[model samples]
Target: MQDNSLPVDIDRRPGATILSPRGDVDMSRAPSFRERVREAQAGRPARLVIDMGAVEYMDSSGLATLVEAMRNARTEGVELVLCALNPRVKAIFEIARLHQFFRIVPTVADAVEA
Candidate 1:
């Protein structure tokens, strides 16, 4: 794992590709995050998981980026999953009712299995 200030770290597994982003994901970092998501999608993996364990904060732009990524993944027939969301971040998704749209799991292992 890297300790850089930047958002994403791409990790490839046997059947899934994980995008782990650290720190707050706001407007300033959402574009970069989106680009990374696109790159992961380009790989055409059977599954794509956004490991949000390191994310302490997220804004509407970040949520928008995720929504866009989900759309792209669906269009390409990729299964997009999210795991390890912090409490605040999880609450945001719940409040937005995005949990209905996303397959959110509590851990990376759960995401991989799902």
Candidate 2:
């Protein structure tokens, strides 16, 4: 099996914050991911973008974190968008039928605009 454990990177843009997460998001790492996202949401931007293009694996815990992040953003009246999802992560979203819960885009620029 491929080693999927890696750290996720979070960055900022003008109108939105970008989280370029890498590696596997599983039970062991989900809390860290949640903390990172929470930190970003705390900034209270009008929109937040999580770039999943580099993510190689995403399990249920990862999905749950994303869902919670979205909820947090919503409560804060900020738009939470997902962008650049790799095939693996996209598949997980499909499996969970949560592909519609987020505003997904093909690139960071697109997500930032939306």
Candidate 3:
């Protein structure tokens, strides 16, 4: 596992891609997050799962990046799902009513299958 102060690792799986992001995804790091996510999606896998179990903080920029990713995935016909969102992150999505927009799963495996 590649470790960084930002705490995110992306692992590509066959027929599915996993973005295991950890730590805060705020303004300073949001661009990197977006770039990494976009790179992951470039594979055009049938499934794109973002594993957020370790994400402790996410600013609006992060949310926007996620929305953009979902948009790209939709346009590309790739199934995108977010998984293991901590309470704060989940609440952000809930408040934004984004919970209804994307498939939120409890685990990476579930997201992969979804």
Candidate 4:
């Protein structure tokens, strides 16, 4: 179990905003994670990229939070992208068949361009 105490980092790019949540995104951190995503969405950037490079683990709650964010992005007409997902986290998305629904990329640069 990785540390869940680390705060989510939000970065504002030219045409996009990146939300980097470190550590495991479990039930305990899901609310905060959702809030971070909402905050990024509030800015109404053309692209909102979630950098999951440092996330080692994520449970159903985390998945739900992401789904909610995706729905919100859709309603707001914001392009939500995910990037740098580790194998473990990526496998979860694959298993859930959510990778097809999301704009998943291998790098932040790719996500930004996508």
Candidate 5:
């Protein structure tokens, strides 16, 4: 198994690709997170969903990484969605006003459908 600092599971479906990241996403792990995202985007899926249910903490670096990913997704014409954000991660988004720009869903099913 690959030793990922931030464990991420990529599920590539027909149209939407889901990236599930577990554990805290801080400075030490943002790079790994970003790499995983890049790997997911490399497939050129129609939509990208970030399932944040298992992430309990995320620092600014993590948020910045996500912002960068969002920009990349926009440029690539890939729909970026965030699903199942735990309360802490959701608060971070709200604090950064990122929630206003991101498509956040209550569940993975909703993200895939969206």
Candidate 6:
């Protein structure tokens, strides 16, 4: 667990860093999420996996934050993967045509392997 204030749990795997956030990802929480992601990327893991299984909802701000993370990951040469997205959150990315850019998978295990 990185921070108690943020609903994030960070786990370090063999070659990946997994961040699991537990709540809605709206504007109110997007900043914290961004900070958490940034911190995870700071470690320079071969892969960064965001487990969205607990996230039920996400707004544009949340999506924007993810986009920023994606850009940063590219610059850092870290593979970014998002997994366990609920239908609602997954639909948001699909509707925005972001699914084409993001490596989204159905489970954390899949993301870890990806």
Give the best candidate by lDDT.
6
TM-scores of the candidates are 0.92, 0.90, 0.90, 0.92, 0.94, 0.93
Report clash pairs, candidate 1: none
Candidate 6 error regions (>4 Å)? 1-5
lDDT of 3: 0.86
Top of the candidates by TM-score: 5
Cα lDDT tens digits for candidate 6, 1-114:
443245999999989999999988887788899999999999999999999999989989889989999999999999999999999999999899999999988899999987
Which residue runs does candidate 3 get wrong by more than 4 Å?
A: 1-7
Question: How high is the lDDT of residue 13 in model 5?
Answer: 86
lDDT for model 1 = 0.90
Residues 12-91 of candidate 3: C-alpha lDDT, one tens digit per residue: 77888888877789888788888888888888988888999989988788899999999999999999989999999999
TM-score of 5: 0.94
lDDT of each: 0.90, 0.85, 0.86, 0.88, 0.90, 0.91
Model 4 TM-score is 0.92
RMSD from true fold, candidate 1: 3.4
List model 5 lDDT by residue over 4-51, tens digit each.
Answer: 489888887889888999999998889999999999988889999999
Which residue pairs show collisions in model 4?
A: none
Pairs of residues at least 3 apart in sequence or in different chains that clash in candidate 2: none
What is the RMSD of candidate 4?
2.5
What is the descending TM-score order? 5, 6, 1, 4, 3, 2
Candidate 4 C-alpha lDDT tens digits along 1-114: 855454788889898898889888988888888888888899999989999988999988888988998999999999999999989998898889888888889998888888
lDDT of 5 at 24: 90
